[model samples]
Target: MGKTTGTRRGAWAAIRRLAASDRAAGLIMLGFALIGLVAANLPLTYHLFETIAETHIGIPYTNIDLPIGHWAQDGLLTIFFLTVGLELKQELTTGSLSNPKAAAVPMLCAVGGMLAPPILFMLVIALFSRFGPGEMGSLILTTTGSSIPFGEMAHGWAVPTATDIAFSLAVLALFARGLPGSIRAFLMTLATVDDLLAIILIAVFFSSVNAWYWFIGIAVCAGVWAYLVQLKRVPWAVVAVVGVLAWVMMFEAGIHPTLAGVLVGLSTPAREIHGETTPRAERYASKLQPFSALLALPIFALFATGVHFEELTPALMLSPLVIALIVALVVGKPLGIITTAWLSTHLGGLKMAKGLRVRDMIPTACACGIGFTVSFLIASLAYTNAELSAEARFGVLVGSLISALVSGILLSWQSKRFADATTDATR
Candidate 1:
């Protein structure tokens, strides 16, 4: 019995260590996503995979019934957003975003990043529309063998605007040897703001709130949560129950239920209280982050990335949707970030963090183009047509993959230059 217990404890310790590592978390999610994709595409496995994803499981006679895939997207993913909110709150109170002057550059760059993608998406639509159906126009056809209207296609404009913090930071951690810590800080600040903007967009554009009274329940739960977290001897069980209730209210209220996680996180006390050495928010986040990284995100990725391509034709590869996403993420993200950083420094008189320059931001800006998690969510919400949604999700996957590869190469080169410079100075 003693030996068995010891072994169980050792196994759990190993799992925790793996969960804490950003690189491990990112690789695991990628592996699961690839599994999901391959399962969706393979002739022998596709039907079973689809049935599993489409199967519904929920409490009876409540507003909670959802397919398995949606449970992954909406239910499990809320834990990830909660962690995002906690980190955002921490940054706002004590980290890089604490000072307005220092934070201006990255915040503006984030805005610029969000704005540029939609513009590029619209431009691609115009290009296809202008050159009727031979080479360019043929690429714009939907999988259903019909032309997509400009308005319908334009709905996916927000898809490429997001930046996946986990994947981007993982790439940075792996390839950014000898780079200054400020580069990581800059990426974090930019991605955090990018997440905030994406959240607002989701709330405003995607929600249909007919059951406003349910918000009263949400508000009460939040108030109780805020009160409980502030106490000297907090009851964590009660807090968890209240948090779930808030999520249920948000779902019934027709707001995206994931926002409930954000609400609870934001409400957590960021300042130390009642003889505590550390703030409650920090402690809570540290405890929950492992779960979010290891379980919540990987499950979401598995469901979100199961895109089945009907065929592997050149037209599909060069489809307007596909081309637009690739350009928006690869070219537009970095272009917007660089331009805004320059403008803020030169014209607005804002400054970057110490030991960083606008030019130094090139690789990090490229990393910002990796829009995976939120982009997938937006794609599902933006289009009701199954074909259009599939196309958009596939585009997101391809675009994020390209951004990851490009950023990795650029970061490796930059790290080499920095390392050589350090060696010469030391000699």
Candidate 2:
């Protein structure tokens, strides 16, 4: 019994370490994205890359039929989203979001971050429509010569609205290491709300279920999940099985299956149970965040970030769709984050997190624009045409690059300033 308990402790320790190394995941994602970019452009490797991304993987007995890329997107990505849901649940129950006064600023900032990007996207499209020739039509809006309708392109607006929490947190871990703990909490809360909003957008706007019964089935599953989580001692394995079943049902219902992650994660108890020492949210995160950060995200990046440079000409690069995404991500994200956060603190009477000023927010807010994983997903969902998808992917890559660079410089500068001030005060 002693030996068994020691082994269990060792395993949990390893899992905790893995869960903590999100910075490593970010670095690995960056390296793989660079490799994907290189492989996509190299003629010798391009065929292999496409094959790997497009290969079909399914259980024929169960009638599961999707490309390997789709599996990574729809199935494995749920693990990552589940971790996200766990974090959100923890915050809402016991962390930064538990306090209404403290939560107000970041929550408002998240709302701003979501609201500003799409409006800018539409406004930019409108500007192009007004001034440019009919050839430069917006991706979602109807232009003089466009074949795509307004409804389709409108879906793409949510692409920039999402803040890739993985990448954003990675940046915070890397450059803002010296900042106050509350700043990290603030950003996490903001990103959580941002993700919650994105998930809602996917459900309301993107769902295309064929029958009402499918939703009824999902609702029943969710009700059971909620009820089970409230119990003192419940079978987690059974919950896992039910979660998978619900995912399949959601997929069949034409809703994005990853919402399964959100549902399960949210249903988990963030507080400690009667018999357990650890909270369910933390327990679930320790077991799952490692798989999510180390495997799921990297694989998704490998499949999604491979953009062939040869296919992108000057015309395609400068197309209204591409340009609009770039501008929205790089400009609109920071603008929305800052504007709304400022309003919350100054006008709405919410206090800023300790040791953080409005000045400190600029760099972090800019980092919020790194809408990598979900942005690419939304882009694909928004446009079925390969050309449009490729262009949007390229735009996301460029915009994230720009956001990373600018935020990196600014964060480094801010850190230096804070350090120097501390030194002076000590003297």
RMSD of each: 2.2, 3.4
Please state the error at residue 88 of candidate 2 in Å: 1.6
- Encode model 1's per-residue lDDT on 33-68: one tens digit a residue: 888888888899889989999999997778588999
lDDT value for candidate 2?
0.80
lDDT at 117, model 2: 80
The segments of candidate 1 whose C-alpha lies over 4 angstroms from its true place after superposition are: 1-9, 132-140, 312-314
Report, for every candidate in turn, its global Cα lDDT versus the true structure: 0.87, 0.80
Evaluated at residue 113, the lDDT of candidate 1 is: 92
lDDT of 2 by residue, 1-427 (tens): 9999999999978766865775777777777777877787788998888888789988656767898878988998899888888888988888877887878888888889888888888776667655543355433432224455444455578778898887888887788767777777778889888888888988887778767787888887888887787787787897877888889888888999998888878887898878788898878887787788878888888777786655534555566677788788889999998998778778877788777877679998999889888888888787786656776777787788888888888888888887888889999
Estimated TM-score for each candidate = 0.95, 0.89
* Backbone clashes in model 2, listed as residue pairs: 140-153
TM-score for predicted model 2 compared with the true structure: 0.89
Candidate 2: which stretches are off by over 4 Å?
Answer: 1-19, 61-63, 131-154, 227-237, 307-316
Candidate 2, residue 68: CA error in Å? 0.6
Clashes of each: 0, 1
